[model samples]
Target: MPRDRRPVWAELLGTLDEKFVANAVVFEHATPCAGLLLRGEPLRTETGALDRELVLRALAHGLARAPELRRRLRPAPFGLTTPAWVPDDDIDLEAHVRFHVGVVATDGPELPVLLAGRLNPPLDPRRPLWNTVVAELDDGRVAIAWRIQHAVGDGLYGMRLLDALTEADDAGAAGDAGVAGGAGAAGDAAADGPGSRAAAPSTSGASTSGASTSGASTTGTSATGTSATGTSRSTPTVPPLEPGPHRPPRSGAELLRVAWLAWWRRQEGPRGAWHEYWRKPFLRRLRRWGGRLVRPVRNHVLVVRGLTESLVPQRRYAFATHDLPPVARRARELGGSVHDLTVALALVALDQVLPDPAGPRLGVPISRRAARGDRRNHVRMTVVGIPPGTTLAEAVPLVHAAVATAVEAIEPSPSRVAEPGEPSRPAATILTTAGLAHASPAPTIPALGPTKSATNSPTLSPGHSAPGSPAPGQPGSASPTRDAPPHPAAPHPAAPHPAPDAPTRRRGYASFVPWRPRARSLGPALVGSAVLWPVLDPRDDLAVFGSSYADTFSLAVVGSRHVDVDAVQRAFAELVLGTADDVVAAVALPAPPGAGPGVRHDPGDQPGRRPDRQPHHQGGGTP
Candidate 1:
């Protein structure tokens, strides 16, 4: 195989790195698939009906720009070598694209409910590992949910793909008009009679549209883009598929040669190949043993002690939005970045809602891509520890310094090959932040009109302070403002220790696990120091994903079934907006089953209550 024979873009798409391979392995063993969910205005025809044609056209344009979507993983024969990226000749647009009509009661839980349903199921490995669903809301809005396997790309890559699917600017107005007109023409043909319309495109054995088989009620037409009464309509012509370079299966001899070359490249250095090969293995063994020896004590002191774990296998999602300007200004006033503020606020809010003796350790992911266009998952994880009862102001500087040091200390290509049933480092929660506003242009859909804030939650505007909230530098502004009484600082009762005869839980090995058990007994016999031991717990209590696009900063919290995601979301919004009674009332809802009573603060509660003990800022370690 000649590397230079392929186009640079195609080569990038086909090149599988250790991190990418690990992601694939993790997906197979533990984690479900991950992707993006975006909401916007629904594209409508002149007659005000959902315009399916325009949606397909926009998707076609996106597919052309992101050729990675048309490729699938081809595993090596009998696990002889790593999987190779190969082109899928049968690119069925109808099978991959679907529509849902008027199923949402409101923008709040319905969309996430739909998203959760879509996310739970794994994408078919045989086909291109991506799917898009267009959802029409009762409020006349549209939510586009696109899910891709983790092996395809990371969060940043997903954002880039989203950019490709959308128009650059108002320039798309004419294109939207053209597509809508074509759809109207098709509708007119359908009106004449079913026989007058163009023939429906041929489909493979797979269902043409997911929504068609979902048994959900749809308005005006069926999910297949035909009338509910079964009249056929001419489907819009989508752009030709532009898949990556096709690589045929290699022979056994070829696989061996490729594997040999890969090993040789690994041995290339100042030292001779023989010395480097032996030395590397020896060092890895030494480190592994050293880690195992010290892991229990380290985890006990830094992770397990003073922490509360409320995680279960089930996940629930809650979203909140903040106006960017005020949050940015506040962060700058506190001598930190928006990311620092985000971490700080999360700590404050989590402590209030799920009060523990100690603040949770946060696992932050840092991207290590060499360039903007790098398609591989070049990323590393760094952990940061916040002291118990630290106020927002105190937490910000600590978080800032910790994140900076962690980023500086990250080694290149630190991702190790994932092994089955391997335990990951214990972190109570994970925080992921992406500045989409600073990335590529925001997705623009003329038919959806200007992109607006997806949430109806109240936001603080520029030069505006939260209600009854002082300026950042003023007194009473150091801690997050609260409208509900703070929950008692006492930690929730620790989970009951596993029964003596109960099987020890095996922590899942995956690139991502939403929630997991918190503590495991390593036994005093193994450490020869303490009776109680601490080991890596693969599950986390919570994961907060924050992204900024244009003027809005959105935070989505995914938590375990026992956790009250909605309460966390509300607390986050309150902290960000600094508003009081009305905001809380508007956002508050009954807590989900298994959740504790919602915590509300009194208006008289002080905002600058300092911690009684000295704050401890734990340095970053492997996540």
Candidate 2:
């Protein structure tokens, strides 16, 4: 076989990182044939500042690097030096260019992180990176969705791509981390790729008309610790905090306390299991419960191969993007952009549920895509705290500053990622490395879409036997609609507001095993975590990025019937709506969120996500 002589970009795409755990699952169940091929979606912005033409040019550049793209698409693995997947570049274009872009319903259950835990997606080892659907909602919002092989990028990489293309002026380090930090001269030796904040051609240059560019938004730069994993939480109906303009700069000690407090609050309760530093026995119980109840929920047939029918089940998901322009505007009265103020509102929402303020730690991804080859799939997952002591008067900045610290801590390339670990088997891994993929069809708005059953016939099945007719994507199974492309242009709006200009929220949801097994039905937390990943190939880490006031905002999710969905949708929306002002302030003035050098300082630990099942790419957790 003649070795691929293509440029790094060209050869890169030739061999998808089959070693990733997520890749194996996708390969095993891919429609028996390859589906679509697209990179991630374009960054969403209310300002419509993205340089579409430049984006096209970037795509063209990617096409020119066909060999690399082909290499990226292959269902095989490399000898694991980061799987030999990343390509060198000067801009954060690789992540965007590697796959195609598409959208899903704005109103649906939040997407989960497939192959995140400790297993990898299964792959057929015969195709290319499957697909990425950039979903556009009628409510003026957008979602970048995909299912590339797990071997490609880690959670950090996924987060990096999402963070890079986001509107830096506002999304600054994806909420807290989105603060504009420093600048770097493009193509300069000291700032070439990975670690530098090199300048990209703006969406306004002569050759540019629509595509937008970015400057690193991490304000609170630090050699801080990176943590994107956290406990699952529900939407709380908190009353808005009294508006105010207050606070003086905190001493270093005070700053750390506030940041940790915020982080601890989210991680303290039952929802805080996600933050458990060491896997506890309770974690085992949760998995056992999931396996007993959720995994074998529906059995198709052994005709599918390796697993049984119940593993991957067909399901529906719904979420809401409640509109809050009124509340958002009102929030500005306190501080920050609509984004920052939104976080203040979310703090109110979450507070409504539990009063005790043992704030929890949460993970936020930092995009290293801006650094050339780093973009191939270089996601830098970072964690930040909501500060247990965060108060309304101090929240906007409190969270802003804390997240800022997290964003700055994520370097383009981990300082010393141990020689990439040996690839693991698929299936058995946990959620750590897994990414959740979803499909939001026709209705487009947060209303009812088509309800067709997914199928995985014996011919398509590798060997496992499923019960009834094999449906597309059963739990522990896979269902891919590669042939169907999301509406090329946002679909006809289901609501009177037909235009995709308004950030619409998707409202579809599906249920998974419950966090609390005793409940008759599962809630959004588990459903959002489990259901969303099976539909699309396991490569994408599509989370919910929505507004709080959108019509469907986590409202109606109370009764048993709606529990599985309504809640998760709202939580995803809250995540989107939450924002911080001090985060921006910190970035503008160079205040890293917390303490430390930001690198994976746990010298004895491995910083990458571990997926279960499959190879190099995988998800984690006992299940």
Candidate 3:
């Protein structure tokens, strides 16, 4: 039915998290925008001014096919209902597609800063929740960067939108065909295709121009000799926008249905009341395997631990390389995928800087591709404890096993209905006596404090902590310096202590965190073997996000102005790449065809012919 009610999922997410943090600092500017970097020829007029007409035409054409792009969110009166998607009666393309005059160094270290600066700002709520920044790089290549709100779509949908925009000729053609149908279709076509004429800037009584610039906009008409009023002699023939009727409000029943559906999709539940009763039994088994699920913190790295409620504006640092072939080859040899290898590499790198190796509870984002709803955050998490100073060979297996177990556990199981006599829901606990009903709450159990790992103990030296043991002075520690001063370079603590009476120890599994707390701590950081994959046009690809995070890691690293970008990159490369090499070396190769007495030389081996076997993939198959 095209979901006429409203974006229930988006409303839920928006309300759940009002803030996002990273690297122990709150990310004040986390507005959840899916960004893209596209490389293509600069679309400029011969006059050297931005070809507003052509650009608008092509963009409009693309938007025509994607109705979601044309829709603007209208929140219900006083937040009484979910935000509904309505057609933007006033569509302004120029305001959305802006031209940047600065020289963009696409491959340099400055690229991350450029992207963060552009994305940190929130998308205009009144308009279509998207913007495109077209900047000309120093090398004369054009970089088209897009920032679309996550509330509107997800990674896959964002990719589809970009795919539509890039196919200029096809988009324009489709847009032209749509225009002839009706005013509504015409508006969609005008949003993306070059075949349609562009609406002049509302403020100016100027005519659109057919002439394209040789380069992007740096100087206005003052440099290009074009009229400031935009009155050009060659305006292309295209249909003008005809105002459409105001969209009718959704029915009360429809609105109620949406609200009900959102409630049904919630993670914690009435059925989950069983967890409250079954928690003790589950904990007993978890304790036997692994102790309390304490999240591992990177104590070695520097951090600015701001107050949990305070707003801490944070920035991101991104560096990518075109060299992944060697690492990929090595991963296959170690009986692991590239993802497994990446996790091992990250742990190895972190261990180098950490005083002790028993990693904090590291959360790996696992993608829930099979999720039913079309919500953006369709992902689960897997927490893995990286052992201290573990070799790449050993770590890969550990990573693989941990991820497999987490993914399997998170999978949705068939719902079990309670018997007629049993209380399946909390509401069912009511008992009627003497015409009065009394609610009987479930029996509350005494919560246990955090359990100290049995193997957790002290170490003789900072780097010499024994595997599976806790750091000095930590619970269950036997070190003499348990009361020694904290290390001067120790990383900032992540958060405040949990409530005194709360269960200090709990089993680790795929569990949902409260929206506010999770949002407050979510920010950008190097996580889960983050790999940089270059696109067909490396110059155009603004960012390359590793899909592994959707399914394995959400490592938010907080970086500051004082952070050394080059130095950090070098250390990271040394750890991840070095680990890859270690894995490849550890793999044993088949002893070279058993050097036998009967030496048989074929014609191919004798002269210019090819050898029987050339150096191909190692580890027996392609990574």
User: Which ten contiguous residues of candidate 3 have the minimum total lDDT?
Assistant: 514-523
Candidate 3 residue lDDT tens string, 191-300: 22224221111121111001011111111122442322221222343343333343323554554455556556663676665564375576554542231122114211
Candidate models: Cα lDDT each: 0.38, 0.24, 0.32
Q: Mind giving the per-residue lDDT tens digits that candidate 2 earns over 1-623?
A: 76434422212221123223222233233321111111112232244332233333322222221322233322112121112232222222222222112222122122212111111122223333433222232222222233444443432232222222221121112222211111111110010112322112122111100000111111011132111121111122222111112231123343344434544664767656465635547675455334334322222233245342224332222222122333334334444333333333334333333222334222222323333333233333232234333445454444343333333333222453433542221111011111212221100000000111111110111122122212211111111111111112111111121234532221222111000001000000001111113222222112222221101112112111212322333333334334322111111111123524421111101122110000100111111
Question: In model 3, where do residues sit more than 4 Å from their true spots?
Answer: 1-28, 32-42, 46-53, 106-109, 117-121, 153-157, 167-310, 353-357, 369-371, 391-393, 412-568, 571-623
Residue 428 displacement (Å), model 1: 16
| 2 or 3, greater by TM-score | 3
Which one wins on TM-score? 1
Residue 421's lDDT in candidate 2: 47
What is every candidate's alpha-carbon RMSD to the true fold? 19.5, 26.7, 22.1
Better of 1 and 2 by TM-score: 1
TM-score of each model, paired residue for residue: 0.55, 0.31, 0.47
Quick one: ranking by lDDT, best first? 1, 3, 2
Using lDDT as the yardstick, the better of models 1 and 3 is 1
Q: After superposition, how far is residue 245 of candidate 2 from its true place, in Å?
A: 57
The TM-score obtained by model 2 is 0.31
